[model samples]
Target: MENCSCKECVSACLNDPGRLVPDDILKLSQFLGISIDDLKENYLVRVPVTSNGHTAYALAPAKKKGQRYIANPGTVAPDYYAEEKGRCIFIDDRDMCSVHEAKPFECGAYMGCRNTFLGKPYRAKTVEEYFYKRWKSK
Candidate 1:
């Protein structure tokens, strides 16, 4: 397969923010110079995993609702970043990720033209366990 530029993958992320594991959250917190708790409280949304009786965290999208997308006002994305609909809060005016270096595991492993790596099962399970532990402790 030819190496595809990140355009497609970046577009997909902009459309739908990916789910984040605990380690990803930690990395984002460190990158944004914020506490993990603050990040969770302000920028993450809890999604119920009913089958497992647990919850997963996904990054929040921009606030404006319309046919066009809106970049989060709180982030570094320029005000003119609005385009398309349902963009992730972290995508900037240039369609670049503001937190590219600390992107979630799924985003990091995604390859639009190749078989994607969904992370090791053992690692996912371990992270899930850790996430729940921390969630409950808080």
Candidate 2:
């Protein structure tokens, strides 16, 4: 999506947050001026991710409820937006990304406002593969 803020795109934020790559985590940590540990404790949650039958825990912005993210992994927050969509913790009440400057790669890659990808739509899968390798090291 480019130069568009359609309802579908806005619904993306209302549905679920995106997965945070390692770099996303670091960026958010610095942007918030907090240690990674504190960020994890307060803003991020570990969720299960699976690819090719292998599963691992990945970090993402927490879900908001009662003024804070449901940061517990064992809690009821949706792990994947495609499967069980929910609200992003960073989305403002006006339906905009509050942390738009430092949003996750997964958020901006696949879904677009006009449902029009800049070049290749499959970049989403490509990015997922890239991150899968990164996470494999953990």
Candidate 3:
């Protein structure tokens, strides 16, 4: 927790670091109205099944496609679907999230894009505020 600011960490972790370090999957399970274990099993361990080959970190493989994006053989999921999946942990691109609020578990665990502020690198003050700042452009 070195160099950790209270508000920023709280914002990043999405719970009171005072009460407890929030279990991200647990929080997601609660929000999705599903069992924690089920959520973890279904989302965390399961990789997206993509036919374009693979993105390295994607939970599932990309579905097959007709030739729009050749890097992978399949059609890339639209931004909307990608966003819904959250952090797009399939590759090295951490900056491209189609969804933030409802992103998938892998996206949630992504620490690469944290601490960005107003186009500057800094700790986000809170999750709510961070989303407001990050996604307001869309």
Local distance difference test, each candidate: 0.54, 0.65, 0.33
* Residue-level lDDT tens digits of model 1 in 70-122: 54333433433323346666677777778877767656654544434443333
How much is the lDDT of residue 55 in candidate 2? Answer: 66
| lDDT, ranked from best to worst | 2, 1, 3
What C-alpha lDDT, on a 0 to 100 scale, does residue 128 get in candidate 3? 34
Could you tell me how far off, in angstroms, the CA of residue 119 lies in candidate 1 after the best superposition? 8.5
- To one decimal, what is the Cα RMSD in angstroms of model 3 from the true structure? 15.1
Instruction: Write one digit per residue (lDDT tens) for candidate 2, span 19-72.
Output: 777788888778778887888777777666666767666777776655645555
Q: Model 3 TM-score?
A: 0.25
TM-scores of all predicted structures? 0.58, 0.72, 0.25
Better of 2 and 3 by TM-score: 2
Cα lDDT of model 3 by residue, 1-138, tens digit: 123324433333331111111234456567667785555444333222222332222222232123222123223334344323222222223322222344433233324345443334544334334333322332
Which candidate gets the maximum lDDT versus the true structure?
A: 2
